[model samples]
Target: MSLKYAPKYRVFLFLIFCIIKACDVLFIAYMIKLMLNLASSGSKDVTELIKLATIAGIGQLFFTCSNFFYEHLKMTIIKNVNLVLKNANLNYLVAQAKNDTKSGLSLMTNDLKQIETGRVTAQLDMCYQSILFIGAISFAFINSWQMTVIFIVASIAPALVQILTSRLITRKAKVWANANADYTQHVSDSLNGAEAAKLYNVQPTIISRAVNSAQRMEEALRSMNFTQAWALEVIYTVAELFCFIIPCTIGGVLMMHGQLKVGTLVLMVDLAMNFITPVVTIFQEFNQVKSTDPMWKKTLRALNYSKNPHEKAIDQRDDFIDLKIDNLAYKTNKTNTEIFKDVNFSVTPGKKTLLMAPSGWGKTTLLKLMMGSKSPSKGQILINDQNLTNDWSKLHNYFSYVNQKPFMFDDTLRFNITLGRKVSDQKLRQVIHEAGLDELVKEKGLDSPIGENGNQLSGGQIQRVEIARALLSHRPILLADEATSALDPHLSLEIHETLLKNPNIAVIEVAHKISPAEKAMFDQIIHLNQTPTD
Candidate 1:
């Protein structure tokens, strides 16, 4: 949604303040003109000068208060708009493609920040400058229409300069934004792979790659800045020649010819300066707004993103969920390369199913499909006899997913396990025992900080924490994708037995290797291949 009309009353008040501010400028010009006339006429009376000074002082006071209120309103509007954009971008990101996620991140962080810092000020300035320019020019015309015409005509040069350079400024700004996104993505990737880089002794290589990305981003930023600076310099130079030099020269000639009074000449110069100030400011603000057009377009696009129109909401009734995959197929959206086809499976309530596949097979993909993170290219995923193709939002209500590398926040162990959900101490202890986390709890207590992404915990401990969370959720279906891959053999077997033995819940686990004893515990074993089968 456009924020053009946000905080309507405040915007109206700001416009009124702009008008008051313009009036203040005109009053000051009039007072200066009166003072000049008194001095030129050699009048001994100081009453008019005192009266003009008093009026100008009152105008200055009003101007200051109006300016303060205007700034306050502008900030409030900017804050509201920022909040709206943040919420819209977050909602869109949740449903966006993985490849596009980074772009959304950039928009929410850097792009929004730019709008806050630059665009908000530019918007307010544009409004104020336009009003001030009009008021100042009107007064100048009242003084001498002939000189006002010449002044305005000369000002066109600067406007033309801005118009010509605006496109290049916008183009450079877009390139910089894209480059910055790439740099952000690369930094995120490097940080996520820090452990791998360290273990492989490739820190130097990673650093080099990050430096190169930063350099590219820096170059783009420098280019954008240089372009903006050049445009401003050229425009300002042309504006100075017309707004100051030409007007003063013509006004002086008129004054010498006695067609214009010295007081009137002074007033015209002051008013013309006021008019020129806003005109120059308007051009600068226009360039600034134009430069941010790319970011604004990106933000708008993200906000406009809509899910598949054909997608329907699922019924949210509390019932046991039995999933069925009928001839499921999937392919890469970019390459159109089929990962798998004709995949068939069923996850019945109160039963354990094991999915086995070799490396390069679509094991995780299949699990994601079940969880509704991915959609099947062909066939249907039925949940409790209802098609789940487009109703992925409801999947969370029925299932708990335990990924291979479960993410943990930088919070206490208890917070990570409960995820801010209230749970009884008895139930929490029970799940911790079942998930083999009792020892860790006893050793460090539930209040121990887990560090970022559970870095404080070992791999087995992280997996166990994930299982405990899943168990605590009490969802009917538990989906585990290589959940025990990081655990030792004995711990892996214990976790597997714990999940499979839970008679009240349905479990579907994917693993490349499982012992025969573990395999026998499952009600069915499905192997994913070119044609998946049970």
Candidate 2:
């Protein structure tokens, strides 16, 4: 899977390296055979040995140089392939409307590691081993065809072992991959909930669950490793019995009968081992590559998803005349129960509307649908009298969202507020003032770092930063979902005033609880139960 992403020229270069390696092996074997022949001939001159040693030394040097380039090319290809895969994985996660960080982490880390070793490296090894096997067999056949035939016949056992265990190895690999992902999720959950667990005195429960997940993960890994090892062991045992012992015994008998020269018999035995080793190795590599089927399929799916049409250019606008929902409805897939039914609403430029609904009435869900983070089960959302598509990339452009918990990356305040967009300092300052974030800017400056999820800022200040983001975006509609619920009364009123005072921006805030005075600031208020308030 990853090999396809490797540069074509680099792959060609690597294949050339494999051929050179095979040639080097054959040359070394030939040198050894010549040395054995010299010894068998009862040569007395030390000069001939010296000459052979000099020639073999030069060959060894050339082989070492070829090996260095070979290893360098292998790593280069692996690096290039991994880069492509990681980028595709990142784009896929970012393109999602609601991404699971834990799942993404698992994919990028655990699954990717498996694909690297089991699929990419294994495939490359098979190529190298196959070429080397061909060269060795050719050498052996040149020396003694009868010995080569015996070696080939005996090699069938290793191939059979690989075929029989391929499915079992793949199953084990898949189980290990799944268990690894589960363990990652559990560890993340345990850490994220550590504070709550401590407060509730449930540390023991959390520890127990984490331990159980870890144990399961290790057990799966053990199973996978043991299966792979056992397969290799069987292959090795078969190779030793059939290719090594049988061929060496037959070569000795042939030599005793003078059917083969002493030097030739020794060379055939060495060549037999050479070809046999590659046969076993190729089978091992094939099984390893097969084990990554599940992970490779998952990676391919993500790559395809990242290249989806929806990920292409989408509509971007700074203003909308009106946003309306007509007979908007949503229901749960599991229970077929409506979270909200026949919901109707509309917003025009500069109009401030408050949406009131009791808890469990799907106010947040309705906001999600309007913001395009979720799709409606029925009806359509119209913008400027044109129906909107289900594509969030296009639908989300006309609105800015401020929910109860605004997400923030670990970055500078400026980047967090503007989201890495190129914004003029003048415009930035104006929005910061409008959002009542002037005090924070005055104290910390825009370049100050905001910790992850804005933990560096107070609840009220984080809400103000969210407002600053919304205002800076110049999005016409502000969809605030319990945006001030986390703040105190004073800060809530202040946030509400800042949100409502923007005459050019329409505001649609949904909340079940708000001070009456704060609620009265809206130009119009509508209840989810079809009630209206002045």
Candidate 3:
């Protein structure tokens, strides 16, 4: 849903506010006219003055109450719109095949805030001011048509200025948004790699890079602010000159010539000010909305993104999985260089397959392609002779993955192992023992917390915990990308033995180094040689 849908009841509140505000303006004009007439007649009736004051005070009360409700409703609408924008952006991010989280993060945090402060505020201001402008012009025409005509003529120049500079403001806004995204991405990259920076003693270099990013962001923002300021100053200056100064001068001359009564002149001056107020306010609001146009367009684009219609959903109960890759290939977009080509492999349930490749031979990339995290530039991956079709969710249900470095949350050992799944104590103990995690569980009870990313545990222990998680998932296929790379040879052999002996699951592993004895135990060993470009 669009942000406009959020103000379900606020529209009615705004209308009530406008009506009461218009009536208050009319009452004030009448009170001013009465006071002028009394002064002209040299009359001293204190009771008449007290009655007018009482009526004016009552009008002020209603105006204030309406305004209170209006402001409250406006705030509520802003908050609701913010929430809607965040959810839309989040859904879009989740649906993306390859998402740039840094850019998305900046859009939700910075761009959304800009929409709230600039676009939403400008819209509300324009709405309120439009009503006030119409009320003022109607009242002024009733008092003196000549003065009302003068005010409209004065407003023409500011309106023209707004038309002339709108495109420039929008372009500047887009530049600022892009620069902010780049800065956010740079900072996120540095923070994620802070440990490496410290280890390499390159903290100064990282800080320097961050400073450069910040400078670029500041430059873009300064340009946007300058353009907005210049536009606002020109419009406000012209509006003030004609709408206020000229109207007051003309009214005074008419009163002096006896062409206008003192009371009429007072009413004309008040209405003239009221008419100019909205015109000036609208000019400011126009600039604000223009500046926010780019971000709003980005948000709209994200909200309207459609998911892939060709994505197929396989039945979860179909557990017989046989992975077959036919002439698979991949290339990098930036360099247009192939990582691998014409690769053929097959893995079936109840067998152990070892994928052997040298470093930088795209072993991990191949694993990702099989898991549907990345799509091949050539060939198709099939399960049970049907095309896998790059549906990660369907593949996710059939396979469990173990990376060289597995991610762990800062939670208890048992919580990390089960991952919030309701597994019986019997199954949990079985998997823990099978994956060689029994000793760790005994040393530190299941309730004990593992630090962030399992930093408290040794590399072997972390790898065992990851294997335990995969074993407990009960998926038919297990894809491991150097799962035992960090473990000692004996532990690695033990883990490999446990996985290979599992009769119910297929184990496909990428191994960099293995002994002759280890190679003999696998059902099939596929060695990948890098394909040279023709």
Candidate 4:
């Protein structure tokens, strides 16, 4: 049930796992013997037999407790792995390293989930139960090895059927993994853009996609379930028929020659009954255990996603000065669709700079690179001649960025403004005033729940809210990406004044609003020409 990606715990846990399984098999065999003896013509020692049974039960109890404790410990390990993954900024890391969201998501979700399913508890439980069954077979062999051989020979039929059917289980599990991803994508697409889907008459399309996702998931699950059930039934029917066939044929032959006692005959019948459950259980759970390999494989596939700088190396704060780029180049893909080549620029402290580019000239790409996203394919971005991209903590802490489409969390004005941080209420008032959020706050107090992504607020209100959140960071250097595009002239003028005359603020606005006085706001400009499509 464990994956190839079994954490370093494997070196120790494997041995413990085996010991726990061995204990269970021993316990089950003792119980089987006790039951057979009870049904035999023996009486006065019933109390002794029950006492032995109690001891067996107690021993099993100890193993069961150990099973749970170790399982819980394993869960802790998994959670620790999650923390490591989260700290590693696995999303950004995987995006940069694997460069594929689908594969990354699979590794994070389906792969991790499957790893959980391969719980050491479940695996050990099955393995131990199988061990008990084989123990019963061992008991039968002691009494009559020839009959045991016949029993095992009959077992081969089920094994053959299982081997042939295992391929189907694997195929279905794969389909299930794909279906799960599709369903998640559908849910994300629909929920993230519910308002747009509704307004643009695309709700039906989203619904159709959702349905397809769900149907695919259902179909895959159904196929797996049906195949498993069919396989089990075939094995069970054959097993049940042979259970009678073996004992009856062997017992009758012995009785005809007067070679067996009634007690031995009765014991054989009891042995056959005892053997049926465990043997079938072994076969069935073995298939389940086998199926788990793929699940673990899927999970490990995600956990094993390649990454660089496996740990956080920098958290620089409050030391940022000039934002300088040196011979930077970046590509969009492996085939060298270079977005920027040898681009160099600097925005000094308390100085404003403009980055202008015609459509499709990698303007946004450059902006993203500066903001700790979309890393450059070549060269570096520096703060005080030391790399900012290498350690964006100072750059991040000292600067605030505004994207073209602002994001809003579904929370109160207080939470939206402070983002769950401990900021003085007085600062909130200033941010609301500076960002001109007074009207929104006045209409509904700070406690008001903003609808999902600020859908209830206008574009301007959402932008202001995002700005208010940024102000809470107190970043000295601010970058705006067409942030004021939704605002009217009057509001734009007020925002421009705040950026320009704000005593000690270094602000760079990616302006789309071309006002008469706009040129004076920025100290430098880099005009970028449009790219000609080939």
Candidate 5:
């Protein structure tokens, strides 16, 4: 998945950098051997030594420059890959039947970080280390194949250690990822309920709950970190003990028998360290990369999500048509408890319909069903006498929803209304005027920033902003679920008037309580007394 998102040219540059880095190391090692041999000679050549030192200095400088670009390119690719994955996952979550907000948040933060560090960076490091190891071992073999073979066979000990412990490390990482997500959810809940906690004087209880979650998350993280560290340490100890002792012992014996020169023996030892170290690093990097498989798999699912089978390519319609709900029913999947049954409703252009039901009734749920966020157990929603499938893609062009507590982005008032669309100023002002937002625009210019969730605006003003947004979309049908429930009677009446005065759009609002004056504003008031079927 990361490869799918990374730019191919950048990856190619990364490989080129790795090769340059390895060549630099080998060139410097060879230079050291030449200079040492010159110093030990009975009659040293001063000019040859100067040339060797100068070449090694040039190689080191080149390596430094390559290292800088290598790090930069590696991080750039990781950042781009993570951003794409996050956006894809967000879209997938929005398209899901039910929002799993906790998991979504977790995926964006902890899981993505894990994947970036473990899979992406580890993969890049493994490639570089493997290349370095190959170059170093080939150089060592050219110097002395017997010692090189001994070191190669001994390097297997560390690889075996990594293979044995890889599974446990992966399991620990998954546990930590889950615990981190739960902790994030707990923190979000605590912050969102801050006002309620203060009103109820239960801040201590909230703190205690958050602390418990944090402790569990930390424990899991500690276990995961410790397991990974232990495996690497064991691999390191084994690789060093075998690669160093066995090779050095054999090289010393060969030099004593006049089969190898002291200069070449020293060069082989230096090269042997390079070869053995990369072998250990490669195994360690591979283990770390394997630990992120769980997160990578989750990301793949999001990127590979398929469009709804019933989805249509149509985006907008130029005409309005009647919407009908016939014999509608719904039930909970877990409890198998019926919410409502045998419900019926209809709305046509220029109509203002009020669906009045008790507080415990499924009024909000019904609105969700109409908005295509929720599906009914048995029924059909029709537009222009055609079946309306429970898919947002099929419904968004025709229906605009106004929630009781509508969401607001922290941006300029214009963005909150047009949502980054290229709407004309004249048309925006018209919708603003129609939604009773003339005073707001005049007071705080069109570009005035609205704080997070519209905290800068009053409840009535926020409701009006949502109305303004819906009106601007030109969607013919507005399904408002208790849109004015939080406002005072006067404000509620004002909002209802703004909603119902538009003859070009139809309004179907659901609520439990309404002032008679407000109720009179609607063209039709329907009472819902739905019950479960046997």
Candidate 6:
């Protein structure tokens, strides 16, 4: 498949490539002179030979510099293309589904590496070899076009071999890349499920699964290598045989028949040796491309922008509005199962409310829907009675949804707390203290590093940090999904009391159980009980 690298960069790359090719002619001619001089008789002038060698050396230097420039530019093109695809202009389709972090991680690390460091680009380097082959042929024709016939005979063979090899390699690469992603996912799943694996005594099963997966991936890669090797063997056999016999035969015939000078005869031999250089190099490059293409296609396809579901509203509305939900319903695609159907709920202004639901019922889905993640399979949600779907831009302004699992970046804790919002240091400290994280933050400092996903922090501390973030932001509506589940009963009660005291704010907590005191703080309890049909 054709990679749609950024057009501007592609055009610039093509232009530079043209320049590189044009420069090749000068280098080829100079090389031909050097060949002829080396092939000359003992009577030939050494000073003249030295001059030709100097010219050839200069040409070689120019060629190397041009190649270096091409490599750099290609890297720039790849980077720009990848970035443009990653950061959406406005992707609607992607936002409708829940973020699959595992898949995203696989795409970023495993799949991306396959493409960037793999085969197709290797093949692109073969273009230079192709150019070299053409140059060698042109030079050979200068002394003996008859020898150039070798190119015509050998050309189709290489292409045919590459075509068949590429198809097999393509299939193998797909399997290999899939296995790579799967293996990465398995490691992620296993490590993430380490607690469960230990609890269930399934470490053996995990190890077996991991081993089998690695073996399959290894087998696929080996198969690809074998296919490439077979094709290369054919080319090498042809090259060695032709290079040994043809040039000498043609040059000898021309010399004996008095049709060519002795210097030209020697030049033909030298050119024949030089001729294989490009073909060999191009074949190597082609093989690299063969390996890289599948990975490239797979990764870039994943990067394709899936537009946000509420892109239009996000674009159109920007003002803050009160959080509200009307008739709301949702289902999962995997099972076509109703997560919650024909549901209706609300968190009106100036009233702190709690959403109580059984485990796995759809509290998180509902929160995401209200946040204008553009989810919920059916019904309408609103902000201040204004349809949230219709005005998703104001949803974030109106409500802060602190998920059960907080996403901490590799950056600072301070950055995560502020989240680029303009809150003062004192205000940040006050919220942290309110959320009961003042002690932790004091020890580490806000700028102290939090490892990936805050693996360094305890479950309780992470919860408090996220709560601190939501509190510091000061949104009118707070949507907390099992937010206090990580915290101890005492801390959860403190949080409940804090919300109760803030009468002007509205809160929606999706808790498995709220304490009697916490229960008293909430003005209303919205329950999602199983219906007859449910």
Candidate 4 matches the true fold with a TM-score of: 0.72
Q: Taking the tens digit of each residue's C-alpha lDDT, what string does model 6 give over 133-166?
A: 6666676776567655654454445455555666
- Listed per candidate, the RMSD to the true structure in angstroms reads 3.5, 2.8, 3.9, 5.7, 2.4, 4.6
lDDT of each: 0.82, 0.85, 0.82, 0.67, 0.85, 0.66
Candidate 1: pairs in clash: none
lDDT of 1 at 342: 83
lDDT, residue 441, candidate 2: 88
Candidate 2 wrong stretches, greater than 4 Å: 307-319, 389-391, 422-427, 530-534
lDDT of 1: 0.82
Candidate 1 regions with alpha-carbon error over 4 angstroms: 1-6, 97-105, 194-202, 306-317, 331-338, 394-397, 412-415, 418-448, 468-474, 528-534
Error of 3 at 370 (Å): 2.4
Clashing pairs in 3: none
User: Per-residue lDDT for 126-156 in model 4, tens only?
Assistant: 5545655666677677776766666677666
Candidate 4 lDDT:
0.67
Worst 10 residues of 6 by lDDT: 88-97
On TM-score, the stronger of 4 and 6 is 6
> How do the candidates rank by TM-score, highest first?
5, 2, 1, 3, 6, 4
lDDT of 2 by residue, 1-534 (tens): 567799999998999999899888788778888887887888888788789879999998998999999999998888888888888887777766445766778889988888888888888887788888888998888777888898899999888988999999999988988888889888988988999999999999998998899999999999988999999999899889988888788878888898988878777777776788888888888888888888888788767873545543323354477888899988776787777777788889989999988877888878778867778899888888888746566677778889888888799889989999898889998999999998998899889998977879998888888999988878788899999988889989999999998896899999989999898899898888743211
lDDT by residue (tens digit), candidate 5, 238-342:
888888887788888988998987778888888888888988888888778878888888888999997777776445466666989899988877787888888
Off by over 4 Å in 5: 40-43, 97-99, 306-317, 530-534
| lDDT score at residue 288, model 4, on the 0-100 scale | 63
Candidate with the larger lDDT of 3 and 6: 3
Worst lDDT 10-window in candidate 4: 307-316
Model 2 compared with the native: what TM-score?
0.93
* TM-score of each predicted structure versus truth: 0.88, 0.93, 0.84, 0.72, 0.93, 0.80
